[model samples]
Structure formats: C-alpha cells, structure tokens
Target chain A: MLQGNCEILKREQLTETIFDVTVSAPEMAAKAKAGQFAQIRAEGFFLRRPISICEIDKAAGTLRFVFEVRGGGTEALSRLAVGEKMDLIAPLGNGFTLLPQGEVIVIGGGIGVPPMLGVALSYHGRAKAILGFRSRSAVILESDFIRTGQMPVVCTDDGSYGKAGVVTNALVEQIALRRPDLIAACGPEPMLRAVIEVARKEGIPCEVSLEQRMACGVGACLVCACRTVKNGEEHLRHVCKDGPVFPAEEVLL
Target chain B: MNRLAVTVAGVTFRNPVITASGACGFGREYNHFYPLSRLGGISVKGMTLRPQEGNLPPRVAETPAGMLNSVGLQNPGVDAFLQDELPWLEKQDTRIIANVAGHTVEDCEEIARRIEGSAVDMIELNISCPNVKQGGAAFGTSCMAAAEVTAAVRRYTTKPLMVKLSPNVTSITEIARAVEAAGADAVSLINTLLGMRIDLRTRRPILRNNVGGLSGPAVFPIAVRMVWQVANAVKIPVVGMGGIATWQDAVEMMMAGASAVQVGAAAFSDPMAPVKIVDGLAEYCADQGIESISEIVGSVHPWE
Candidate 1:
C-alpha cells in the first residue's frame, strides 16, 4: 500500500448527504481493485477515514470515491474543493474474486451500490445489478451502473423509485429468469444475510464486502475485527487486512 | 560517533526511535511504507501465554488530540510470536522487543521462560494495559505488585528487561523505583492513561469496554512530566514514550532524561512518522552543533 497526498481531480455532491470524489492517484488507481478501500485523512482528524473504491480509472490515473457524511471526519472530507490535496493510504483490504468468464449477479443496498458498480464493471454486460435504496432521493449511481452495458434493477422501499420492495425480491426474480454462476454483494448486515441465504440455497458461490469502524487501515491496529470461521475453527479476522471482501461461507455475519 | 544512536540496557540502537507496542503489530503493516531498519527498534504487539481474542467491537474511539483503545491484549500468543513472527522480524535488521502481558506473576514468568532464548533484543513487560479486566494496569498501579511481576520474570531471562509503566498511577515514581530495585534493566513510560468517552445519543460509552488507554499529542506533556520524575527516581535508563509524534517531541523527551524514545499513536496518524522523526532528529542535531545525540539526554534545566 502507498500513502501520500493525492491531488483531488474532481469532487461532486451526489446527494444531500452523499459525495463523489475523483483524485489523481496514478499509483493507487493503477493498483486498486474492486471491493478494496482507501483511508483518506481529513484535516484535523486523529484517525484517517476508510472509504471504499467506487471506481478505478487506470487510464486517467484516477480513483473515484463515493461516501456518505457519517461524522465529523467524513464531513471534513466532503468539504475539500477541486485543486486541493487529500492525504490517502490506498488500495487497502482484500478485494472481490471475479471469474474471467462467468455470469455474476451484484446486489447492492443504499450507499453500498458504489462498490458494486466497481464489481459490475469487471463483468461488463454479463453482470446484473440489483440496486436498492430508501427512496428516490437516496438512490444513486443508476446511470453509472447502466454505463456498464446493463440496466440496473432498482428497488425502493417506499415505492418512490423502481420496484416496490427490497433487492432480495428482485434477486429471486432474476435468479429464476437466469441462474448466475456467482453472487457478489455489499450492504447492511440483514441484507447480506438474506443474500447469503439465497446463494447458499441455490448452491451458487457468493462473496461479500463487510464494513466496520477501522484504524491503521493496513491492519496493524486490529481495530476492525470480525468473527469468522475457517475449516471448523473460528477466529477474529481484521476486515481491513483479511478482507473487506470474503467468501460468504467464512463470515459469521 | 553515531549522531542519532543511544545505548539502553547494554544494547546499541542505530537511533532512538522504536515503534511502541500495540501501535505497530509485529512490524508487518508499516514495512510496506518504509524499511523496518529505518527504526531503532520495534516492540511487537502485546502477547500473553495463550492466544487472546481481545474485546468486542468499537475497541477504538477518537478524542481531543488523542484516541482511546481498549484492545484488551488481543494477540496470537507468545508461542506464535516466537515461531511465526520473530523469524520474519529478526531479519528486518532492527532490534525486536517482545512485549509480554498476562493476568498473573506466574503468567509473566511462564512467557519469560518460553522466550528465554528467542531472537528478540529485549523483554518489554506490558503491565500497564488499562483495558483488560485484571493483571494489566492492575499490576503496574501498585509498587508491590509491580515489583513482584518484574522480579519473577527477571529470574527466567538473560535478555534486557524494560518495564512499561502506566500514567494512571498515583505515584508513577514509586512504581519506577520499585521495578528498578526488582532488577529491571530499564523502563519505558508512560503507557496510555485510562480514559472514557460516552455516546451522547445512546447515553452509553463509545468503546465497548467503556474505558480504554488514551494516547496521542494530548498525553505528551503528562508523559514528559512522568518521564522526568521517573528518570530522577530510578538509576536505570529511561525510554520515553506517549504522544510523541514529531522530532521536536523527541528532542523534548530526550531533554527530559529519556535515553531513547518510542513512537506510538503518531505512527497511526502518519505511517512514515517514525522514519520522518529519525530524519528530522539528524537535521536538528547537526543544526544545533551537538556532537552526540546522547548529550541531549536529561539536558533540560528545570528552574524549579
């Protein structure tokens, strides 16, 4: 992993509480993979904040980050203007495992949609995205997902947008239409549990990206640990190092 | 003469900046940023007799100029360190100080015996971990308990022993003198001070353990004060640490009577923090026309 001040190439207010930033981080963008993250240092904050890599454009030497204003740290990050510099530790955490040639269904809920877009881009036309949100205003990255040559299946809980329920329903419908070889997802724990259940029952392999309050993003601090099982032995794993992404079978969540 | 070198407990460090234990885990994560040899030494993560799972989530929380961490001595056990971690770290061309922690004097002695012939350069007894339920800071808070654990482990190992003292104590000098009389080679102080942060919304504590050890720039003054007091109280060498981030902080710590210094929370804020301090110290030494960096140790002339 590399740590330095990467120039902010672009910054956009995606919604009332969400933001999108692209930075001129050649080395980092070149090394970044889907489901991985970057720890961006906000001015005056003790610990750097961890945000997932939403898009990695190697050609432009830039990485796009989409994050919600969760606290003082992220709020500070959202305020930086273009032409500014943001200190970052990049391409951290273990990313997703996508087969070279296979159909995959990517499930995303709310802010989790950004990371799925990176995974979906890897599959191009072969990946189907099931995006869910709280309402029309909360929905984001619809057009970005479409740019991957696939019309994303959007779902809203209040029926303010696409379908009238959660993404799990859309997932079941799409599964019956065409059985995907693999399932990739990122979202709240309940949604992940439901997605893992569907993948387990259908016998399709699944991988998930998890989130936790973290420090020393390189995994030395052991602050972002998750209880997981492997080969019948349970152990606490660092989400930042062991993975932000893991095979669904290994995660206790 | 080595400009930045300072000898502590018979071991000659290339510099005086060692990465504090628990802040840098086994020297693996930060190795990608810079070579481990850039540091004077490394105190690996705190270890116990058996693998410890640590505490629940939200183990860390930030505060004014500092952060509270209640990791509760989570480690892969001392055997794992000797078998798996030491071989890799010993090859890093830097001194490795294995930080040992446990719930009892017997526990400390048992781990000391296990690592009696290991590659580590020293034994840093971690008796000031405030996050654990027992035998952590509990052992360091009292002179009798501190002396008991220190003397027990000193009998089992021939390696240099440095006892880490907590700032939460009423009389840190007494504990420092106690460990010194018990045969400690040196002392490193002050470990994080016990602190708490309550959540305004839930009317609860932010950390799952409710309290954690506090460290960062906020604790620098307190650490310097304690280091000054302890250095005066004990005849052994002092390795000052706690909230030391910049080269200026290192200069102040040395002037306060620390033979060497360790960088802790500062490394978390900047991965290259320790390396940067090493570079800056050399520059400061040259600019000040000091022939040897050790000349600055205990140089502060207190007016009081």
Candidate 2:
C-alpha cells in the first residue's frame, strides 16, 4: 500500500541461489502482516518481482525478504548490496490469518519457508516450525526460527538433515503427536495441494499463499488470475488483490 | 487556459492523461494508490455482452523494457458494469469511457446501446484486441470490417464514439480513416502489437495463449510513428497510447499529433505513472513558457 525507496540495511547470501536482506521501510513494516508480500523493483526489469516478507522487524523499522534466483529479475535483484536503495510496493496481497490465544503449526517448503517465519514468530514459544528443503545446503533460517523461542523441525529430501522426507511427513507426524489449532503454508502448487489434502483430512483450518505471473500488482491489470469456488460456483480472483493467501476450502486447486 | 486539459471530440478533459483500456480496470484497484479524479479519464477493462474469464496463466510475460499480455478481454458483462461499477466510477470526478468489444457488429452495438442511458462519458470501440479467437483483431485488421463495426455502433449510441485501432494490420492509417468515415468521433492507437516469447527449457510459448499483444517502451517508437500517420490521415482527434511511460514519452506522443495520451503497461510499473505525467507536464509547460499543453500537439516541425 506504500511505495518507498527503502535502503538495504543488511544483506547475506544465504546460499548461491538464495538471498536474505532486510530493508528500512518503517511505515510499510508497521502496516505489514505475517503473510503479505512486497513487489520489489529490479533495475531495468519491466515487471517487479514479488517477494514474500520473511520477517517483519517492527521495532527495528525493517522487513526481511528472502528469495531464490529464479530468473532474470531475481538474478538482477540478487546482485544488490547493503546500503543500496530498492524501490518497493509493500504489504501487498492478503496475509495469513491468526487466531487469538491458540497454538498454531507453520509449515513451509523450500523458498516457501520464508513467509511462514513471521507467523511462526508471532506465535513464538507456542508455535511449531516444520520446514522442508531439497537438501541440507538449500536449508535456510534455522537460527531465525530459534529466535521464535522454539526449536524448528527441519527436513531434507536427501536425508542429509534432521528428518529424511518432505515437510508433509513432518506435518503429519507433528499433527498426530498433538493437534494444532491452525496450519498455514506457501510453496509449489503440488506441495500445497498435498498440504491442503492433509489439512482437510485432519479437519484443521488452513490458509495457503499462492503465486502467479502478475502485472499491475494492484489488481487493475487482471493478469494474476486465481481460480476459487464460492457457493458451489467457480470464480476468478486476483492473486495480487484477492489474495496470495486464501482459505483451504475456498481454493479450487 | 488550463495547462493540462485538452479537448477531444468537443469533450474537455481536465488533463490530457487517460489510462488505456485493460490497464486501469475500473479504477477500483488503483484508487488505493491515488485518487482517480486526478486523471483526465480511464477506459475500464474491455467488456462483452457476458462475463469473460479471460486467458489462462501465464497471461503475461516480461521481455526487455516491455511486457506482453493475452488477457483476452476478461470482464464482467455490460449490465454488471452499469449496475456494479459505474456508480462508483461516476463519484470519482473523472471521465469514464466504456471500452466495448464484441464478436460481431451487433454485439458491439448492443454494448454501446446499453451505455447510452448511463453516466458513462464515451464509448471506445475495441476492434483491436489481439488475444481473442474471433472479432477482436479480426475486425480491426481490415478497413472495411473496422468501418462496418464503427458505423453499427455509431447508430446505437449518442455518445462520442472512438475506435481503437490494431497495430497488427497492413496499413494502420487506412483502418483509421475507414473508422473515421464510418462515424468515429476519434481514434486511439496503437493497441499492443502482436508478439510471442518462448522459454528455452520448456521449448514452448511463455504465455498460455502462445502469442500476446506487446506494450511498453519497446513499442513506443512504432506507436509514435503510427500516431503521426493516423493523426494526419483522419481529421478526428487522435488519442495516442503504447509505451507512454515517462512524462517525456507523453510530450513526444503529443508532439506527434495526439490530442490526448493513455498510459498503458507503464502504470503496472508504478501506479502513479499518469499522475506523475500530469505533474511533469505542468513543470515542462511552465519552464517552456507554453500557455497551453495543447499548443504542442503536432508541433513537431519535421525536417523537409
């Protein structure tokens, strides 16, 4: 909802492909929520890259962004250093919903792990973080989850890390041990589909963050169309406006 | 004289900046960035007789300074626009031009007729949309077909009618003149040029539609040249678009004979693009000591 040339307060190359940076955008940080995203402008690119807010440091007046170098846009973005200014349209799309005084389980997959951090932190000490990565080196933000006043359960596909399977495996294991009030996630469509199915079977409320090719991130362009069902009928929703996040039942896929 | 306002087809705009069809939607989303009243006008999403779901993703793809979209005129039906969006747009203190697209002449006329009794200010006949299978760029690529649809819609509406021209045609000026002869009060060009992009890994077109209309800085020069040609070909006002991103692009477009200009894909980069162009025009006019921004229209003295 705000445009500012925020200065990069810190930057770290989490891995060769992933990046972690925090920007000084106080007003946007103040208005930001756990599941929202920021459309960061890369120099010379026509479309701004949509990066999910990994963490919101309201006291420090900064918001953390974590992303992988997917293509040209993110490749250009990954090259920026600390002290550089990046133009951003922040706190966009709907964020995950939180319940009052209830234990929650936050699940994330690969790059999808970032969006869940803010929600996990909000429920600090009472929240559980189960993350899945392609391998151990691809893993990120373990220490940050520890900052949430809890130890995280990390899983790698190669079994080079904590658990030897996907986050759904961790999710099912955790769900059976003790039921959490809610589950929230963001990741690949197939993975989200699996997570949604598991949540539905368990009768647990869930919200997921979706991604789409977008232009006019404000929803005026209608490029980022997401399909969902309402009242026994299918409807087209704007991922940029209606949500990057939606309830598990409302989403069609 | 007002510095930014310009008259098109006897209708005065508070500014020469309008958001092109398919760019600003119905002014509902961009309203969060800034007030819509600051714009001279907004051409809402292209509408049909019934609601359209538009093309499936990926509907847009980035290529250099521009982007391509095959949105395929997704919109709520005309009746829904009149009932749901028109009232909210009317309260915004900006001109509302309903952009109508149809598969046939009757379809376009029906939409125009429905807008006749509403608070809408004008009707922009969209014969240039490139994504649809029929009646979009098909009617626009031919002079006779463009004229036929223009004349049909003209008979149905008392509103000032503007025909939007497609750049995919052989001679754009011929289509512009044909629409003019068929009772078009004005002409807006150029709609996105037909373009395609493929991913090397997938070895398939990036957009779901395979091809889309390209807009942005990459197409600005073509738009300027076409606007100049069409502006001279027909006596009707020329509302130019395509890559009118920066304030400088607006000045260059106006100098090429556009009475007004529309900001298209550029607004996606920055929602305040048109508003910034409005302020930039004021600054440029003041510094140049020009009394009216309209004074610069077609003022480019080309070398002999």
Candidate 3:
C-alpha cells in the first residue's frame, strides 16, 4: 500500500445518497486490484474513511470509488470537488482472486455493486452479474456492469426495476439455467450469507467481501476483526488486512 | 539539527516518539506505507505465551474524538514472533520494544525468558490492558500486582524492563512507585482508560466485550496528568501515551515529565502521526532555539 495525494478528476452524484468519484492516483491505480479499498482522509475529520475501489483506468492513471453519505465523515468526503487534492492510503486489504476458465457469476447489492464493476471488467465478458437495489432510484453502475459482463441482471425489492424480489432470486434462476464454475459477491451481511448458502448447495466456489467499522485501515488496531472458521477452529481475522474479501465457506457470515 | 535523542534504561532512541503497542501490529502492515525506522521506537502488538485469537467481532466503537477497542491482546504467540517477526524488526534502525501480556506471573515470566537474548531492545510488560477477561487490567489496578509482575519478568531477562501502567487505578503514582521499587528499568503510562459505549438504535453495548480501553484525543489530558504524577514519584524514566496525536501533544507530554511518548489510537486515524510528530519535535526545538529536546522533560512549573 502507498499514501499519496489524489486529485479529483471527476465527481458525480450516482444517486441522492451515493457518489461516484474518479481521482488521479497513478501509483494506486497501477497497483490496485479488484475488491481492494482505499482509506480516504477528509477535511476536518480525524479518521480516514475506507472506501472500496469501484473501477480503475490504468491508462489514464485514475481510479473510481462510489461511497454513500453514511455520517459526518462521508458527508465531508461527498463535498470534495474537481481539482481538489485529498490524502489517501490506497490498494489496501486482500483482493478477490480470479479463476482461470469458468463461467463466473457476480452478485452485488446496493453500494456493493461498485466493487463488482472491477471484477466484471477483469473477467472480460465471461462473467454474468446480478445486482440488487432497494428500488429503481437506488440502482447504480448497471450500464458499467452491462458493458463488461454478459447478461447483467438488475433486481429491486419493490419490482420497480428489471426483475422483482432480490438478487438471490435471480441467482437461483441463473444457477438453474447454467451452472457457473465460480461465484464472487459483495453486499450486506444478510445478502452475502444468502449468496453463500446458494453457492454451497450448488457446489460452486464462492468468495465474499465483508464490511466492518474499522479504525486503522491497516491490520494494526484489530478494530475491523471478523470471526471465521479455519481448520475446524474459529478465530478472528482482520477485515482491513486479512480480508475485506474471503472464501465464502470460510467466513461465518 | 536539534537533538531529539532519548535514552531510556540505557537504550538510546533517535527520537522520543514511539508507536504504542496494539496500534502498529508487528510493524509489517505499516511498513507498506513508510519506513519503520523513521520513528524513535515501535512497541509491537501485545504478545502472550501462546497464540490468542482475541475477542469476538464488533470489538471496536468510535466515540467523540476517540475510540474504544477490546481486541483482547490477539497475537501470534512468543515463539512465532521470534521465528517470523523478529528478524524483520531487528533490521529496522529503530528501538524494538516487545509488549508482553499474560494471565499469571509464570505466564509473564515465561514470555520474558523466551524473548531474552533476542534482538528486542526492551520488554514492555503490558500489565494494564483493560479488555481481557483476566490477568491484564487486574494486575494494573493494584500496586502490589503490578510490581509483582514487573519483578517476575525482570528476573528472567537482562533487557530493559518497562512496566505499562493503567489509568484505571485509584493512584497511578503509587503503582509507578511500586513498579520502580521492584527493579523496573522504566515505566510507561497510561494504558487506555476503561470505557464502554452503547448503540442507541439497538439499545445494546457497541463492543462485543462491552467495556474496552478508551484512547485518542479524549484521553490526552488525563494521560499528561498521570505522566506528571508518576514522573515526580519515580526515579526511573517514564514513557507517556494515551490520545497523543500531534507534535504539540508530544511536547506537552514531555514537559509534563515523560522521557518519551507513544502514539496509540491516533495512529489509527493518521498512519503518519508518529513520524510527523518526530519531525514536528525537531522543528519545535529549532524554532524555540533549544539545543536538546530533553530540556522540555518535566519542565512544567506549577505556581506554588
């Protein structure tokens, strides 16, 4: 990981509460992989906010991250403008590991869809994406996923979007149509847990990205620890360092 | 350049800024951001006799200007450190302080014995960790227990022994004096104050451990007061910590009677805080026209 000043190349409001920002950080853009995150420092906030890498433009030396205005820290971050310089610790935590030859199925929920954009792009049209949102208005990055993946499915809870119900409903239908060799997902804890269950029943290998309230984006403070079972024993693993990503079966969630 | 060197128990440090235990891990994670040698010292994550997985999830809660953590001293055990982490740490041009924690005197003694003759510059007995179920804060709250643990570890090692004292005690100076009398080379205080936070929406405690150690800007003044009291009562050197974030806070800590200061929770928010403090101290000394940074140690003069 590296710490440097990133200049905002572009900033846009994806939704009322969500923002999509592209920043010029060559070093980070070069080194960052899919599912990794950056710790962003905002003006007047003591803590650096951790946001996942939504997409990357290596040729242009820029990276895009989507964030929601959760509280004061993110509120300050959303106010950043073009040409503004921000301090960031980038390419942190373990990223998703890609498999060689397989029909990959990607599942994302709400803000989780952003990280999957990078994953879909990495798979080079061999991946199918299932995105879930609360409603049509909360949808984000649907066109980006479609541009990268094959047969991108967008679902909403209130049936105001492409498909009704949840991403899992689409995931179950997709599994029956074509059995994917692997599954990669990022979303809320409950959604991830449901995705893992389907992957396990279908015998498809799955990896998940977890979210935790972290103090230090590095492995140090152990503030972002999550419980996992490994070798028949349960232990605490740091979400910032050991993972924001882990094999779905290994994580208790 | 202004002289920022500090010698605690005969171990010389390039500066007076040390990364407090539990905040920096074993120095590998932070090393990716900057060189570890840029700071004066690194008190590694608190270690135990055997590997510990620490507490359950939801172990941290952010409060106003600070945070509460109940990590429970999770570490890879002493043998793992000696085999895996020590070689890399020894190469760094900074003082290495092994922060040891245990449940009993034997546990503390065994950890010290294992680390003896290793590359560590000092052994910081973590007698004040407040998050554990046993042996940590229990020893720190009592003068006798603190001294006993210090003497137990002191018997097994020739390295400089620094007892980390907790702020939860009734009298911090009394505990400092007790550890000093027990042949401790130096003392570090105050470990995070015992605290807890509740989630209003859930109507439940935020941390899984319920009460964790509180550190950050909120605990700065309390740490300075305890450091001054302990420094006045003990002849051995004092390493002050708790809520130290900036160079001004470091200088304030030194003036209040700390030979060195450890940046703890603040490092979580800003990874460069300790290194910045080191640079900030030199600038302050140069601007003040002070030849030696030691001139500020215990220089606070209270009106009679």
lDDT of 2 at A167: 84
lDDT of 2 by residue, A1-253 (tens): 9999999989999998999989999999999999899988988799899899999989888999999999888998888889999899998998988777788888889999999999899886778999889898999999999988878999999999989988898899999998999989888888899999999999999999999998888888998888888888888788988999999888977
Give per-residue CA lDDT, model 1, range B1-304, as digits (tens): 7799889999999999999999899999999999999999999999999999898878889988889998888899999999999999989999999899988889899999999988889999988999888789999999999999999999999999999999898899999999999999999999999999998999889888898889999999999999999998899999999999999999999999999999999877899999999999999999999888999999999998
What ranking of all candidate models by TM-score puts the best one first?
1, 2, 3
TM-score of chain A of each: 0.98, 0.98, 0.98
lDDT of 1 by residue, A1-253 (tens): 9997988889999999999999999999889999999999988988899999999999999999999998999999999999999899999998999789979999999888999999999887989999999999999999999987889999999999999998899999999999999999999999999999999999999999999878798989887878888999988888999999999999997
Calculate candidate 1's fnat.
0.56
| lDDT per residue as tens, model 3, B1-304 | 5399988999999999999999999998878767998989999999999999888878888778888888899999999999999999999888999999988899999999999979999999999999887889899989889888888888999999999998998899899999999989999998998899998899889998988988899999999999999999999999999899999999999999999999988877778788889999999998998888989999999779
Model 2 B-chain TM: 0.99
**Which of candidates 2 and 3 is the stronger one according to lDDT?**
2
Model 2, B11-42: lDDT tens digits are: 88999999999998999988888899999999
Per-candidate interface DockQ score: 0.73, 0.79, 0.72
Off by over 4 Å in 1: none
**lDDT for residue B207 in candidate 1, whole number 0-100:** 89
Cα deviation in Å at residue B78, candidate 1? 1.2
Clashing pairs for predicted structure model 3, backbone only: none
